[model samples]
Target: MFKSVLVANRGEIACRVFRTARRMGIRTIAVYSEADARALHVREADEAVLIGPAAARESYLDGAKVLAAAKATGAEAIHPGYGFLSENAEFAEAVTAAGLVWIGPPPAAIRAMGLKDAAKTLMIAAGVPVTPGYLGEDQSEATLTAEAARIGYPVLIKAVAGGGGKGMKRVDKPEDFAAGLASAQREGQSSFGDPRVLIERYITRPRHIEVQVFGDKHGTVVHLYERDCSLQRRHQKVIEEAPAPGMDAATRTAVTDAAIKAARAVNYEGAGTIEFIADASDGLKADRIWFMEMNTRLQVEHPVTEEVTGVDLVEWQFRVAAGEPMPLKQDEITLTGWAMEARLYAEDPANGFLPSIGKLEHFVMPDGIRVDTGVDQGGEVSQFYDPMIAKLIVHAETRQEAAEALAEAASHVQVWPVKTNAAFVMQCLEHPRFVAGDVDTGFIAAEGSDLAAEPLSEMGIEDAAHRLRHFAARSGDSADSPWHSLTGAVGFRANAPTRITQAVVVDGEAHVARMLDDDDHPMTRLIGLSVTRVIAFENGSAFDVSAFARGGSGAGNPASDGSLRAPMPGKIVATPAKAGDTVTKGQPIVVLEAMKMEHALVAPFDGVVGEVGVSVGDQVVDGAVLATVAVPDAR
Candidate 1:
């Protein structure tokens, strides 16, 4: 085994790799950008080095800086954890050229699978069933459209060099093919610096099933069963599970065998994943599955696979890098129990899943589960990186039990100030279609509005009212109390009949709450001053209600004035409306890019644009006003 290894990544994956390396008695080194100077991973490593500025292109993506840091720290190997430079073939070769062990697959294997079109060709030549698609080198739009026609309608235009659903689009008809192709190519160039694309047949009802494969320098390859990642939003996975809920013995064998064959085809070494898109319109079957793509590094959802197979994949990566043989053969590996993982992101489901960036004032993670997090209480979630806060993983003897545990765990999460998708995840776990194993890529689009709905129960509202009274009284007695009187009455007793009416806003809607007494309540166990967060449990699920004291009833509403604000900190990509432009309700005014996604700010009502505060290419912070519109006169 190598004596020391340097993790060439950041956030949770870096911390995860360090944990395994430390347990194996290997010294770990961490590299960080300017933004991550005080990050948790930096504190956890044996030695740390600052590479460059906060921007990824200046720091994380710079291979020379990473290699210099590794060499300066005397690291024997470098582990590229999942993202950044993990799948960069040139970086892998450079590391090897520097006489350092590259703790991943050989550069040749990475190059073979780096491009989707070429990889599909290789898979087909190796007898591995691949999805029918156009992998030609012709870059003309006319050629792609004609190929799409040949493939069939409802085809997919995917970036040959894309992942994470960045440069992908589904066109259901010829009328939309041109627009879809242009959009896909633009995103591809922006994200991957490659404008080339491939057309494939889109499965009507698809289930994303991927098999975890491991190979060693001695030419031994084995599979670690499979993970069902059908629960997705915007073509990105939200929840993943191992030993797919409906997978049978015959189907498992077929997929696993095909995965191993693909690995051997590339002479693959180290950890890699072979992802397959199964046509579940008729349920999972051996022949219905086809190769989609291969991830040439450790996956974000690898924890679920580890939980089920009782294998230390990272440790295996180290061993394989040291030229060791496979730890366990295919026959020896066993799937003992079911496991599920939910990715908790700092995003607002109510606001088109826009990324929420701010300090985590009160972050309370649940116990009795595996939580891989990058931030803690008082941690800053900046706009320079992915907004994933943590991953909640649970394992149980049965799939139902695992699902129930994961949902309950998601409810126990307590995040303040910044919004999260915790509630949305809980809803998916408890949804009838999800719980009954009837999930697909279209599940979120079919039932997302209902899942994202924030409906406060009657009891929850009452609990918030009670908690508000408690906080108000607590604040009144403080030395720095802002109010002159607690209840606006002198010598008022706790049991007095005087009632205080205060307006509380929950999820942007205001509600009138009455506080009669200060009697202690069970539901008000957890309360905060000024801002009271009430967590209520219903039917074995958790719901969070944040109640903030409103300014007043007659106060001028911001919405009425037509002030367009930046929802989160981002750069203005487009500002279509100018000053004095007559705009109708729901008209796009400003487009902001943050957390790797674009969001448009729309006019709230039919009105005339009065002033534009921001211009294109300018950066703005959260809640910053971008434009203003004059309120339309009442008809």
Candidate 2:
């Protein structure tokens, strides 16, 4: 095996690769941009190097810089830990040219499956069943329209270089084909530097199932079963499970066969995933599955496959790169238990699922659950990168058990100081159809509201009480206060009624949270408000936390914690702090950018910065804390 390796990506995936590399006694090198200098991945690596600025263009995505980091660190191999340069054939070629092992497929295989149009042609020639569509090389608008007409209505105009759903569009009618093609081509060119596209038949009620295939240079390959990636939002996978819930023997064999054929056609090596779009309108059948695309590196959802296969893909990558043959054959590989993975992102389910960015205040990973996280509490969720906060995976004896365990595990996971979809993921698992394994790509969009409802229940009182108690404790007041009685106790002090405006999720709808009158106690809570801005956990049926006193003298309530606004869901690109930095309100503490846009989340009110939690370039979700401010004492 190679003595050392370089991980060419950041975040949970980088940390994940390092974990396996460490277990195998392989020295791991981590490369980061200026923004991620203090990221978890950097801290976890055996050696680290700075690549460039926070922008991926200047850093992570810069293949040359990554190659240099590998060479400088004397890394025997470079592992593009998915995303960034993972699938870039040029990067793989560059890594090998730099005299280091590329822990991925050969450039020949990557190039063969790199472009959608060409890959489809290869698949068709390879005799793997393919969805009938246009794979012509014409770039003219008129030609694509003509092709769409030939394919019939509801055709998918996908960028030949597309993956992660970017540069792909579905047109239901001929009239919309032109615009969609144009959009797809533009996004494709911008995203992949390839503007070519292909037209495919859009299957209604499609179930995404991908086969994990590993090949060694010894011309041996084996399939690690399948993963159901049907649950998605915005064409991006949200939940994935291995050993597909409803998979049968015959169909599973057919899908696996086609996946292996696709791999063998390219002479694939290392860990690569073959995604197939299954037509579930009439239920899964061997013949109904068609090739989608090949993910030429480790997937974000690889953990699910690992949970079932008991195989460490990273270890295999190292072994394969070091000129090793397949240790096991297809017959020896077996799927044990069912596993599910949910990608918890910092996004607002209520607000059209917009990405949320902020700093983590209370960052705690759930116990008994496998959580791969990069940022800690006080880390900035910047808009500079993907908004994914963590991947929560669980395993069980059966699909039902796995589903239940996944829900329970998701419920226990928490990442406060920012908004997350953990609660929503639990709700999705409990959704009627999801529990029945009746899912599709439209699952999140169709039953989204019901699945995204974050009901607070009768615990707002308790949540508020907890917050109040914490406030009181911080202010050196009695922990046991009459918070329950004090809730909504003020009718109209003198001038105007107390006003509290918040957005709540009720039955999947965003409702204006009106300030409740003193006697208008319905008892039931809404949104995530246990009573009213309070919190209740799965272990509690009733929560009654005392209200915090102002002014902190044990007589009045403390002032509200200033709101920490998330610029948008992205990566934290930069910050400078050492815990003792005295900062005033509105002082620039950190620079956060999201969606290629930048913003500064400064001190909300004049106070000393009590904690500088995050460093430059950390991924954050919405509503996470960038820093904490300690209000000054009265003169």
Q: Point to the candidate with the largest lDDT.
A: 1
The C-alpha RMSD of each candidate to the native structure, in angstroms, is: 6.4, 12.7
Q: Best by TM-score, which number?
A: 1
Q: What is candidate 2's lDDT per residue for 1-635, written digit by digit as tens?
A: 78898999999999898998899898989999888888889989989999999888999999989888887888898888877888888888888888888899998888888888788888989999888898887778989899889889888888888888777788999877876786677667756788899999998899999999999998998899999999987678889999886899999999999999999999999999999999998888898999988989889999999999898888888898899998789998999989999998887665446666766644555568688888876677776788887998888898899888787777655454466777778888989899899999988879866876433332343344344334334443333433332332111121122322222222222233333344543322222322332222331011112232121212333573744545555456546444556666667666565553334567767766666667766877667877666676621
Q: What is the C-alpha lDDT of each candidate?
A: 0.82, 0.75
Error of 1 at 272 (Å): 0.4
Pairing residues by index, what is the TM-score of model 2? Answer: 0.77
Q: List runs of model 1 lying over 4 Å from the truth.
A: 457-459, 462-464, 467-564, 572-591, 600-621, 624-635
For all predicted structures, in order, the TM-scores are: 0.85, 0.77
Candidate 2 Cα RMSD (Å): 12.7
